[model samples]
Target: MISTVPHNVRGVAASCPQCTSSLGRIWHPDMRIPRGWALAAGLFYLLALAGPFVQISIFGRLQRADIATGPLQLTVQGFDLVGFLVLAVTIIFPGIKLGIVLLTLFGIRLEHQPTRFLKAIFRWYPLIGPWAMVDVYLLGFLVAYTRLTAMATVHLDLSLFALVGLMISMAALDGSLDTGAIWDALDTGPAPRPIDADHRGGHLIGCHCCFLINRAEPGMACTRCDTVLRDRKPDSIVRSWAFVIAAMALYIPANLYPVMLITQLARTTPFTIMGGIVELFAAGLWPLGLLVLLASIAIPLVKLLSMACMLIEAQRPSGRHLLGLTRTYRFVAFIGRWSMIDVFMVSILVALVRFGQFANVQASTGAACFAGVVVITMFAVESFDPRLMWDGAREAAPETPPDPTLIAEPA
Candidate 1:
C-alpha cells in the first residue's frame, strides 16, 4: 500500500526537453525509444571518432589524442588519480553500459530474438544505468575549464570527439531505454512483492540496522538482527543515529579540505566545494548560485535531516506529515548526487584546459573522498525503502467496519 501521490502531481507532463510537448509519450508495455535519438547518437559517435580530440604544439611539433592517450595526458599532468577514476566511471563504464543498452536496442532494431548476452546485459542494467555520468561530468568540467581556457591555447583531438560520441551514445541509450518497458520486451517478470501488513500497527516493518522486516514472533529465529522483540523503535533509532553521526564526521572533512585545487604556473588555488558556490554568489550569478547551493549544500543537509526524520518517525509515528516527509526524503536522496558538480568541474578543467608553461589545473585529493561520500550516502538512501511508509496500510487496504474493541494504534 504505497501512499499514492495525487495523479495531478505524479505526472509532470514529462516532455522532450529540447522540443517541448505538453504530453510526453506514455511509457508503456510496448513502448520503444524514438528513432531520431539513435540516428543522432550514431552521428555523434562518428564525429567523435573522426580525428584529434586534442592537439598540443610544443616547440612547433604537434601531438594528438586517441581513446588511450586522453587519459595518458592526464596521467602525465600530475592528475593521474582523477583521470583514472574518470577513465573508469566516465569513459570505460559508459561505453560498456551503453554498448549493452544498444545491444538490447538493436535486438528491437533487427526484430531478432535476443541472445543470452542480451539477457545478461538487461540484468546488469539496473547497476549500469546510474553510472552513465559522462554528460554530467562534461557539463561540470566545461564550466570550470571556461575560466582556464582564457589563459591558454588548447587544441581538440580525436579522443575529444570520441568523448563527445560517448556522451551522445549515453544520452540516446538513456532516452531510448525504459526499465518497465525493457522488462516487458525481454519477458522479465513483474515488480517485487509488497511487504506484508504490520500486525502491531506501526507502518515500519524493517529495521534500519539490518533490513529485517517481519516483527519477531514468540520463538521466531531472526537471521539478521538478533534483537529480542522488545521495541523496534529503540533499536532502529540507535543504529540509524550512529550512521548519522558517522556522516556528520565525514561532512566536516568533506567541506574543510579543498574539494578541488586549481594549480597552474607553480601556483595552487584551493577551492572547497563551498568556495566554488561562494564564487558564484560573489559574481552575482544568483540562479547558478542558488542551483549550486541547493545541489551541493542545502540538499545534502536536508537529506541528512530526512534520514534523521526517518528515525524520528519510526520512534514516534505520531507525526501527521509522515507520508509527505517520506516522499520528500526520497526526493532529497534522488537529487543528492548532483552535488558532484564541483568534482565534475574539476574533471572538465583537467581534461579541456591544458597550458604547460603559464597555467594548468587539476583536481585535488579531497574530491575523491567527497565523491565517495556522495556515493556512500546514495547507497544508504537506496538501501532505505520508502515503501515501508505504507506497510501498515496493507491491512488497512480493505476498510473494515469500525470495531469498538480496535482503537487506532499510535505509529
Candidate 2:
C-alpha cells in the first residue's frame, strides 16, 4: 500500500521536519456527554426535587418535608453538617455541572480556539460528572430513613418533590451532555487526529527536544529540526514494573477500609464498597447490590490493572498492543477519580445524617484511608504519562555519524 505519511520521522529521535497538525472539528451540539451520564444526573435532580412530596407512614400518622424547607431547613434545627452536605452534593454540585455543560454545549455552540478557561473546564470534566449521584444518595437515605421510622409514621412533604425534581434535572443534564464531542471541539486545530492506525515504521517517531508524540516517514528526518531519532526505550520494562508496584500498594486498603458507616437504631455497620454490596445482596436487594459492585468495585480494579499493563508496555516501547495500551492508560487516568464514588457517598452520608444521639453518621479513619487510595491511584495514573508509550515505537539512529569526505559528488 502507498504510504499516506510523507518522509519517515520514526528514524529521527529528536526532531520533526513535517509541520504540526491537530485534530479539530465542529461537533454536533448534543454529542458531548458520555452515554446516559448527563441524562442520569438530570433525572436524579428531578427525583430529589420530588423527594419532599413523596411520603411514607408509621402507625396511623403521616408527616412531610419540602425541598427548600425539608432536610435542607434542618440547618435551622442545628443539623448543619447534614444540611450542608445534602445541599451541596444533591443540589449545588449537580446544578453547577449541568449549567457548565449547557453553557459549553449550547451557549458556546460555535467551536473555536480552546481558551485557557475551556481547557481547564475540560480537565475537570470527570470530577464534576460523577458528583451528580442524587439517586444513589436518595437510595441510601430512603433505606436509612425507613429503618429509622419503624417506630413512627414517616411522611412526605415538599422536599420530596424537590428531590424528585433534582433527580430528573440531573438525568436531563447527563443524558444531554456529550464529553468526547466536547473534547473534539475544544481541540480547535485543523490537523487530523495523530493516533496511529497501523504499526507502520515511518508514521511513528520521537521528538528529541521533548520526548513527545509525533509522526514520521520511513528514513525521514525529524519533523521538528530534521534530526534523526532512533532510540527505543532503554528501560521501558523495568519502569512499568515500578508503576505496577505503586498501584498495588494503594489497591489493597482501597478495598479493606470502611467507605460508609450505617447506623440504625443504636446498631452501626461499617461498610466498605464491597461490604455495601454484600449487605445489599444479603438483604435480597439484588439490583442495588449488582449496581454497587459494578460501579464501585469492578470498575476500579479493572482500571488499575488496565493502567498497569499499559504503562508497562509503554515503558518498554513494545510494538504489540501500543494502541490498546494507549487507550487503557487514558481510561485508567480518566476514570480513576470516579472510583472515589464510595468516598463521596461517605461524604454525603456523614453530612446528611446527624440526629445527634437519636441517629448520626460520621466518616471514619477507614473511609479516609480508602479515599487516599482512590486519590493516590488517580495521581499515579495522571503522573505516569501515557505519552511515554510512543517512545518505544520510534527506533533511534546508530551512533556512527556519516563521514563528510565519503559524501557523493554533486551530479
Candidate 3:
C-alpha cells in the first residue's frame, strides 16, 4: 500500500511499504512541470540526432558525424556489442524515456483514468532513467573533442548545442516528475488489497519493476505487472560475486592495452587508458585528463573494491555500518555506468576520425576489455541485494544495556 509521511512542512515522502522503495516526494503548492519539460526535451533530442553533431578537418579533409555514426561505425568495425550499447544508452533509451514521460503526462491530462499499458510504460521510467546516459555521453564527447583537437581542426556543430539543451531539458524533466502524484491521478480502480501480515512469516515481496507489494511466493507473478516476485533477488550474492570476479579479471587488460589505436600518416600510436590521460595532461587539458583518469581508471577500481568490501561485510554476522554499506552499494550502482564514458568516447572517435591513414581511430583490444569491466560491474551492482547486509545485524544480540543512572527514582 502507498504510505505518505511528512518529510518536512513543505514536502512529504511517499513510499511503498513492502519493498520500501520511494514513490516520490509531494511538494507543498505542487510546483512540478513535467509535461512542458518532457516535450521540450523530446524536441531537443530530435534536433540533437537530426544533423551533424560535430565536424572534423584534418589536412583539408572534412568529416562530420551525427549521433548514429558512433554506433553504426562500431557495428561496421565488428564491435557490435559496444555499438548496440552506445545506441541504447545514447540514443534509444533516452528517446524512449522522454517519449514515455511525455505520453504519460499528456495521458494524465487528457483521460480521467490512465490505462494499464500507460501505467506500465510510466512504471518503466524510473528503472530505465539512469541508463539514458546522455550526460555521460556528452562528457564522452568533451573528451573526444579534446583528443580530436590535438590531431585535427574540430568544430562543434548545431547538434552539439542541441544535445546540451537536450541534456538540460532531460534533467529538468526528471526533477519535475512526481511519480506519487502521477500514480494518484491514475488510481481510478479499486485499491489493491494489502498483503496479509501473517502470510508466510509476514514476508512480503515488492515487484522490482513496478514496486507493487504482494505476499512472498515462489514463481508468483506480480498482479500489477507480470514480473516474478521474490523475497530477495535470486542468488544475488553468488551472481554478484561471479560478475565482480570477472570484472576484476578484465580490469587488468582494460588499463594495460591501448583502448584506441590512432593511425596518423602511417605512424600507428596506441593509447592505453593511462597513456591517454598523460597525453591529455601533456596537452595542457588537465581537466579532461582528470576526467578520463576518474572515469576510466579510478571508477572501475573503486567499484571493485567497494563491492568486495560490501560482500565481505554482508557475509559476516557483524553488521557494523549497515547504513554506510547500503549507501556504498547505491553509490556503486549509480556510478558504475559512468565508466562507460571512455567506451562511448572510443566509439565516437573510431567512427568520426577515419580519413584513410591520414588520420584514423580504431578500437583496440583494451576497448572491449574496458567495456567488459563497465558492463560486468553494472551487472554486479544490479545482482547485489543491500538487504542482505542488514540480515546479519538483525540476528545479532543487543550489545549494550539500558543505563541505570538515567532511570528515574521510584516516587
Candidate 4:
C-alpha cells in the first residue's frame, strides 16, 4: 500500500513509497492569500499594457512605447522568433498563469463537483509558472533604460510604474502560493493508486506532469491527466547532451559576432556582447555593466558546464555526491533563463530608439545566436532528469555478499 511520509522534518516534502517519488509539499494553512495577490496582479498587468510604458525624447522628438511595443517592433524588424518568445513569456504566459490561479481559487468556493478541465488547469500551474518572466523582463527594462538615458532623455511613464507593481504583485503571488495546499484543495476524488506488492515487472511509475503515482508500464497514458508515463525522461542524457553541445557551439559565434548595431549621426557601430559591457563601464555605468557580464557571459557558461557535469555523473556508477548533484541540477534549471536579460534589453532598445540615420538601434546576427544559446541551454536543463542521478547511485550499490555463517546447511 502506498502511504504519505514526510521526506523532511519541515514537512516540505512527502514521498510516495510506490514510485519513490516526491508527491507534494506540506504547506501552512494561509494559502488563500495568493488568490488576492493574483487578482491584484492581473489588474495591474492590464493597466501596464494599456498605457505608454516608456517615453524617449530624441532631438526634440518624443517617442513612446507600451509593453507590446518590444515584440511588435522585433517582428517588424524580421526577428519573429525572438518577438514571439518575448510575447509568450512576458504577456501570454503571465496572463494565463494568473487566470488559472484565479479560476482554481474560485472553483474551490463552488459547492459542486470540480470538472476535469479545472483539474487540468491546476495541474499545469507548476509547469507554466516559471515561464511567466515579468520579473526578469523588468530587469531587462532597467538595463535598457540605463542605456537609453545615455543617448536620449528617457521618461518613465505611469505604465512603467504599473508594470513594476505588476511584477511585484506577481512575485508576491508566487511566494504566497502553496503548491501542495492548492493540489489538496483541487483533489476531489479517490486517493492516488497504490503499488501492488505482488505486481510483476518494473516498479510503479509516477507522472511528473500530473503527480499521479500508479503501477503501469512505460508509454502508458496517465489515468488522471492522460500524459504519457515514463520511468524516466526518455533519452534524457542524449537529448541534454545534444542541446548542450549545440548551445556550446552557438556560444562561440554568439560572443564573437556583434550583438547590436548602433547608428548615430549617420555612422554605424557594431558592439559585441563584451564590447557593450565595456562601453557601459566606460560610460560610468559600472553596476549595469557588471549585471550584463554576469547574466550574459557568466551564467550561460556555468549552466553548460554544470549540466555537463551532472549528466556525466548521472551516467556513471559512482554513488558519490548524488544529493549535491541533484541540488546543482535544480539550481541550473532555475538560473538558465535569467541569461535572457540581454536579449530582452536588445528588444526594448530596438523598439524605443528609432530616429532613422540620426539615432537607431538594430539587432545584429549575434543577438539571434545568443538567444539560441540561451533557449537551447534552457531546454537542455529541462530535458535532464535529476532522478537519474539517484537511480544510478542505487543501481551501483554493491550487493551484500552471502554471509558465510548463514550459508544454507547441506541438504
Candidate 5:
C-alpha cells in the first residue's frame, strides 16, 4: 500500500493523519498558464541581462553595475571560483532553465509531440531549477542596497525592475507547474526496462528524473524516463561524509578570515562575516542584522549538525522520530543556498564601490572559503538520499514498520 507520490504540495497542507505523508496536489493547474508565465519570465530575464542594474555615487564619483558586473569584479579580484559560482547561479542556470521550460512546453503542444526530445530537455527542468537562484539574488541585492544607501546616493535602474519582474514571473511559473502531469504527458508508452533476474529479486526503484517506480536492479535504466536506477544513490554515505568533512575544514577559515576589505580615506578595514552583522546592528538595523546572522552563521552550523545526525541515524536505523529527521533534511537542503547571501552581498559591494582609497570594497579570501562551504554542503545533501533513512528504519523492524511510501497515491 506504499504510495510513491512525490511530496510537492501547493494548496492547503493536507496529509494523512494516520501516517503523516503529504497528500498530493489538491488542485491541478492549467498547463497553458505555466507556459504564459514562463514566456513572461524569459522576456524579463532578457531585459534584466541587457541594461544597467544599479548606479551609485559617492563624493562625485559614479559607478554603474549590471548583473554580470559583480561576478566580473570578483574574478578581477582573483576570486575566480566564487565569481563562476555566482555567474552560474544568477545568470547561466536561469537562462538554461527558461529554455528548458519553453522548449518542453512547446514540444508537448506540437501536433506530433517529439517525446524523446522533450523528455531529454525536461529531465533537467527540476534538477537545475533550484540552482536558478534569481529570487535569492534579489534578497542579496536588498542587503547590498541598504549598505550602499548608508554611504552614498544609490539609483535603481531598469534592469533592477526587470529582475524584479523576472522573479515574480518565475515564482508564478513554479507555483502553477504540475510536474506530475508533465511526466504523464511525456510518458505515452510503457517504461522500457529489463526484467529482474536476481535470486533476491529487484526491489522498487524510483526514477530520479520522473519519479516513476520501477522494479529493477541498481544500474538499470528507468522504464519511463530512461534514467539510470539505483537501490540507493551510488556511494551516498561515503560521499556525504567526504563533503561534510571538507566543509568542516573550510568552515574554520570562513570564520577566521575577513570576507571583505573596505578602504575609506586611505584607511582600510577588514570585515569578517560577524563584523558585518555587528555593523548592521550598530546602524540600528537589527532586523536585517538578524537575517544576516541566521543566513550566514546559524543556518550553516545547524545544517552541518543536522546532516551529521542524519548520517549517524542512517547507520543504525531506528523508529524514533524518523519523520522529523527527514523533514529536517529537507529544511536544511532548501535553506542551504540562502547562505550565499553574504557572498552575493560582497560581490555587489565590490562592483559598486570603487573610489581608489577614498571609498572602495574588495572581496577577500574568506569570501571564497565561505562560498566553498555553502556549495559543498549543498552537494553533501544531494549526495545523501533521504530515502536511506526510511530504508534503515524498515530494516530495524521489518514487520512493525509501516511503509513510508504507502500513505498517498503516486503522482
Candidate 6:
C-alpha cells in the first residue's frame, strides 16, 4: 500500500534521530527573504566579473588580473585540467547556480507556482550548490593576498570587493532559502495514489534532492519531484571504495612534489604543500597558515581515513555508535570541498605574479595531484551512501520477538 503524505505548508518531516535521515528542516521556509538575497548576489556577481580582480606592481611593471585571468594563466602554463576546474568552480558554476535560483524564483513569482521548466532546473540546484565556491575562493584569495603583498606592491581591485559582496550575499541566500518550501511550491501535480487500509507497514524512500518521503517501490519516481526513488544508492560501496583508493594513491604525489614554482630574479624555487604552509607560518601568519594546513593536508587525510573506516564498518555491520558514524559522514561530506583552498590560491598567484624574469608563479605537477585528491575524496563521500551504514546495522541487529500476552483471543 502506498500513501503520500500531504505537503505540509509549515515545513517537511522532522529528521529521524535514530538514523540521522533528514526528511525536512526545523526552521520555516521564507521565500521573500531569499529572493532579495539572490538578487543582491546576482548584482554583486555581475560586478565581480566585470572588473579587474587584483593587480600587482613588480619593479614598476603593472599587471592586473581579471576573474578569468587565473584560469587562463594556469592553462597557458600547461595545467589545463587544473585551470578548467578553477574556471568552472569560480566562474562558470557560480554563475549557473545564481542563475538557477534567480530563474526559479522569478518563475515562481510569475506563475505563482513551479512550471515544468522550473522543476527540471531546480533539480540541479542542490547538486550544483556545493561546487559554486565563491566563499572558499575568497579564503584562498586571502592566503594568496598574503603571498602577493610579501613579493610585490599589491592593489585590491573592484572585482575583489565585488567578490566579497557576492560571497556574503551567496552565504545569505543559502541560509534564508528553504529548498523544501520551493519544492512544495513546485508540487502542482496530481494527487498521490491513495493508501491501502489493510496495509500497515512499508519502506519509505526520501527524495535526496527534495527530501519528499514517498511510500513506493525502489524503481518508482518521486511523486513530488519526479526523482527516481531508490531505497539506497546503487553500487554505493564499490564506487566509494574506488574513489577512496584513487584519492589515496594521488595523496602521495600530491604531498611529495612541489605544488608551485616561485621564480624571482631568474631563480626558480619549488614549494611543496608542506613548504608553503611552513612559509606562511614563518611570515608570522600562523592563523592563515593553520587554516591552510588543516584544509590542504589534514582534512584530505582525515576524509580518506574516515571513509575507509566507515566503508569497513558498513561491510561488517556493527550496530554500535551508528549515530556517531552517520554524523561523522555528514561532517566529512561538508568539509571535503574546502581542500580546494590551496588550489584556488595557486591559480590566483599564477595569474597575478607574472613579471617575466623579475617574478613569476607557475603551478607544478603536485598542485594537479592535490587537486585530484580533493576532487576524488569529494566523490568518495558523495558515492558512499550513509543510509547503507544504518541498513547494515539494522540487518546485523537481533530481531525482537512479539509478546503473546498482548495477543487478542478470538471466539
Regarding lDDT, does 3 or 4 come out ahead? Answer: 4
How do the residues 126-243 of candidate 3 rate in per-residue lDDT, one tens digit apiece? 7788789999999998888888888899888999999999999999877777665676566565676644333334446767766556655757987665667877788988999999
Model 3, position 324, has a per-residue lDDT of 70
In order, candidate lDDTs are 0.55, 0.52, 0.80, 0.81, 0.86, 0.85
- Residue 28, model 5: lDDT of 62
RMSD of 5: 3.7
Q: Please report the candidate that would top lDDT against the real structure.
A: 5
Best-first order by lDDT: 5, 6, 4, 3, 1, 2
Find the 10 residues in a row with the least total lDDT in model 6: 402-411
Runs off by more than 4 Å, candidate 4: 1-25, 192-202, 210-212, 399-411
TM-score per model over all chains: 0.65, 0.53, 0.87, 0.88, 0.92, 0.91
- Ten-residue segment with the worst summed lDDT in candidate 3? 402-411
lDDT of 2: 0.52
* CA displacement after TM-score superposition, residue 382 of candidate 6 (Å): 0.6
Q: Poorest 10 consecutive residues of model 2 by lDDT?
A: 15-24
Clashing pairs in 5: 2-405, 2-406, 3-405, 3-406, 191-223
Better of 1 and 2 by lDDT: 1
RMSD of each: 9.6, 11.9, 5.8, 6.9, 3.7, 5.8
Question: What is the C-alpha lDDT profile of model 5 across 279-300, one tens digit per residue?
Answer: 9999998888999999999988
> Model 1 TM-score?
0.65
Listed per model in order, the count of residue pairs whose N, CA or C atoms clash below 3 Å is 12, 112, 0, 0, 5, 0
Rate residue 46 of model 1 by lDDT: 53
Q: Is candidate 2 or candidate 5 better by lDDT?
A: 5
Predict model 6's lDDT versus the native. 0.85
| Tens digit of per-residue lDDT, candidate 1, span 31-54 | 345344544565565565465555
